[model samples]
Target chain A: MLDTLDLKLLEEVADLHGLPQGAYNIRKNGQAADRKTTANIDIITKKDKPGIDIVVKPGTKEESVHIPVILSQSIGDLVYNTFEIGAYADVLIVAGCGIHNPSSEKAQHDGIHEFFVRKGARMKYIEKHYGEGEGTGQRILNPKTIIEVEEDGIVEIEMIQIKGVDHTVRDTEVRLQKNARLIVSERLLTNLEQTAISNITVELLGDESTAQIISRSVAQDNSHQDFHLNMYGYSKCRGHIQCDSIIMDQAHVTSSPMISALNTDAQLIHEAAIGKIASEQLIKLMSMGLTEDEAEAAILKGFLK
Target chain B: MLDTLDLKLLEEVADLHGLPQGAYNIRKNGQAADRKTTANIDIITKKDKPGIDIVVKPGTKEESVHIPVILSQSIGDLVYNTFEIGAYADVLIVAGCGIHNPSSEKAQHDGIHEFFVRKGARMKYIEKHYGEGEGTGQRILNPKTIIEVEEDGIVEIEMIQIKGVDHTVRDTEVRLQKNARLIVSERLLTNLEQTAISNITVELLGDESTAQIISRSVAQDNSHQDFHLNMYGYSKCRGHIQCDSIIMDQAHVTSSPMISALNTDAQLIHEAAIGKIASEQLIKLMSMGLTEDEAEAAILKGFLK
Candidate 1:
């Protein structure tokens, strides 16, 4: 029982082009719908748990799944989703959340997502959050993500929130075991007095574990943002963090990156930069018959990409 | 008459390998000494001024001068020096100050230097400051530099302070005329609870003026450093500021760069990064049979250079 707006939002956030025949998919709006089960994946919910459990069978071939949550108005309860991958499985998950509030009341979504990757499993997860409305309603989101990687497991996550949301606070935590790897990329843009804060923590708990975190953000027209990335290295591990931001029109941004090592063999490094667009970049684009504003927008798009 | 210590200090600061017979030179301890005059240069002291006046004749060929100051012990008076360059002149000035105190008392040096560059003139100025002693005495330096560049003028300044300074506060200001350009490069190293603060301001007052400021610093063993660079663009000008710092062993560093454009055609940008030495650099160096400490020191030296 989906409407036109729901279909459009699902397409926007989750890239749901057509109905699936064999692949697993989950559509949730306060309750689950169109839940599928296949030979390689099993999606089930328990009576005592609040969210569903996804089990990818061991030694499964490369596969994909989509889970999109949408809300067209204010909701009364929170949303919780969990995913568990088995050993030697290779899978990709495309998931996101979108809220549309076209009224005078405030609408919010607090999403909690947890993922567990077993030995030698590899996973790629992408999530995008957005809001759009012309009314005076406030669209807000507070998302918390927890990830655990077993021995020799690999996980890569990409999160993007580009426009329309009034406020957001994203919290992410990840732990890596022996020979495990984690990579996270975040892109955000805030304008018109909107605010955002991102707190990310990564722990390299075993030998030869590696992690990298990269963030790109833009603050325009009195918007504000703060980013904190903390990485801890226990054994002979490696970690790196990087933050880049562009500030315009009295907007403010602060980035603090901290790396602490408990052993001499651990190597960690970080770098941060905050400034406006470079003149040479703009001039080079304008030389190709683009206006200044168009050149700036193109450069921003490339940067986020 | 100059003593042996004075001669050694001059050699260390100004690189005075041999005495020049015709070049203009001004050596000051508490007062000016070894003042010389040439055909294209005249050194004169004014009655109402606390410093000397250096006049370079217009359309002169390339020339070189050395103005080095030394303070072997504590001094109660402030040192002031000024230079005035005529139109279409080209010159290079090597200037520095050194303080040596081997007692329990604190030693201080406050030097003020001003330069007036005429239209179409070009200049390259280099200054090196240092302090050395074995006692519990503190070495403090407060230096102020002011520069005015006329139309089509060019000025480049390089300042270095490597070691042995306990405390220092450096202030520099510059004003640029039409089509003028200014460039400044600073290198510093602090260790063992030392502290340093650098404040710089640049004003582009005419059309097509350009400026660049770059600073590289190192803090080790509980040292502290702060850098502030402010650039104001009032016309169709361009400016960029960059700061990079390395911190180790509980040291702290902060960098703040501000660019204010008052015109539509003006473009400005800034970047700052603070962190420890990169592991790749250290590993690359150590792979060449160097020790870890040696590799770190070599990296620091290369960064300062």
Candidate 2:
């Protein structure tokens, strides 16, 4: 069964006009309704893929579940295929390795869109890429997600790359109807190699629609990273993209966020900074007898803080 | 005669107790010897020629007065070379530059170094390099400065560049005595194809001495810039080097801040970053009825702020 928090999130999505009428329908399979708008899958461990495989109506609110375990550091590209977001269901929970697909470039686009379409739901998914073992490869695992939305829906998506991951790339695309909205937030931790390019594109088809993308990245050592964002605002929709990166050591970071306003009043702002730990600060700390590692850690903490 | 402010700053330099001594002296021409420890000299500024040309005794205090009506931008560096700070006197002053340098590079570095070598003086200098005309190829006017400090003296220097400017380069070198201290700071703002490279080297010959270098540069358009800071921390002296640069559009920036911490406990830190404007933020601002130029200006102001 669905929990209260998940229910609340679904309600919010529905209330936000993120779904269209008749987008979702109830269906049954065997002794159980194969897709229950109310029932939530308990868990989908690798030992037992016991979680419910959902089929969403065009525009129904779906259950939200937390998948804590699906992270493989070595995977280069993971494509989400075969999952469709229906017009009725407005939410999708990618609990485990949401998009940390190493090989399948179309995993999220193909796998995830299939479920959304079957469920008839406008999708809002949170993909967490977890890592195990000593992560190698300049290419961290990436989960590529694609969404095809009907008219008048919304999608709020977030991707957070925790520490200990090698590198990560997030490529997401959204096709929105009139008055549709998409919000994407991405957070990147330290320890990734260069070439961590995160690309996001939101295309507004409907009039007065909107999209916003926010990205934050922290780089240390010889890491090289880039954040590329493109928002195409058509039909008089408004769009925004913002990226911030903190560089430490010889780490190299580049951010190029672009917006194309095909129609009048289609609006966009970008800002970036590069700085080093102040030396007076280091001397002040070293004067206190803290080791070099301690001093570096303190500065990093202070910078993030 | 040396004023109270000048004397106080000199005292601060002398108090460091860890720099090459006798390298800095003050002499006053045509003045009777007196009990005052300050050296004050009188010199006539010949038209189109440097006013103070003189020498100093080893380990002695000398002073000379030269009031040149030069551009404000050219004062510091010119002052540096005129007195040969590294070879002789530590302090030089050109009463004031009543004229502004306008867009001339030769004018800016004219008298930058005179007050820099004063015993134990650590100071910050901020320069605004904006002009109405197009920026030139030669942005920084070189001013020679020579300094041999006594044991246990200290110096800290900083230069911040803001507004639009052309190419610039300044060469600086320092040799420290036992237990001396020295710090240097450089900041650059370049738009278009401007290129500026500052070459600085500090040799720490005495034990227990210290030197630090800090620099920041911002490049825009097709501009290219570089920084090279080399420090040799001989004996038990400490050396620290840090440099950072931010590039936008097709801009390119590089930094090579190297430090040879010959003794244990010597340390160095360096960092750099390059990124373009965020698209989402621009869209957001544009949605607020701001033009693209206004949005960019706002972001730049906020970033520097």
What TM-score would you give candidate 1 relative to the actual structure?
Answer: 0.63
Judged by DockQ, which candidate is best? 1
Cα lDDT of model 2 by residue, A1-305, tens digit: 33343233333223212222322321111111112234322211122322234444444454553322222222322222344455566555543232233432222211122233322245666655444342233324555667665666667777765554455566777777777777887776566354466777777777877777777666776666666576665565666666655556556554545444444344432333333455678878988998877887787665443
Error (Å) of candidate 1 at residue B216 is 4.8
State the fraction of real interface contacts model 1 keeps.
0.00
Q: Model 2 misses residue A210 by how many Å?
A: 0.6
Report the C-alpha lDDT of model 1 over B121-148, residue by residue, as the tens digit: 9989998888887768888878899999
By lDDT, who's the top model here?
A: 1
iRMS of each prediction = 6.9, 12.2
Candidate 2 chain A has its poorest 10 consecutive residues by lDDT at A25-34
Predicted complexes: DockQ each: 0.05, 0.02
- TM-score to true structure, per model: 0.63, 0.39
Give the least accurate 10-residue stretch of model 2 chain B, judged by summed lDDT.
Answer: B27-36
> Could you tell me the lDDT of residue B185 within candidate 1?
98
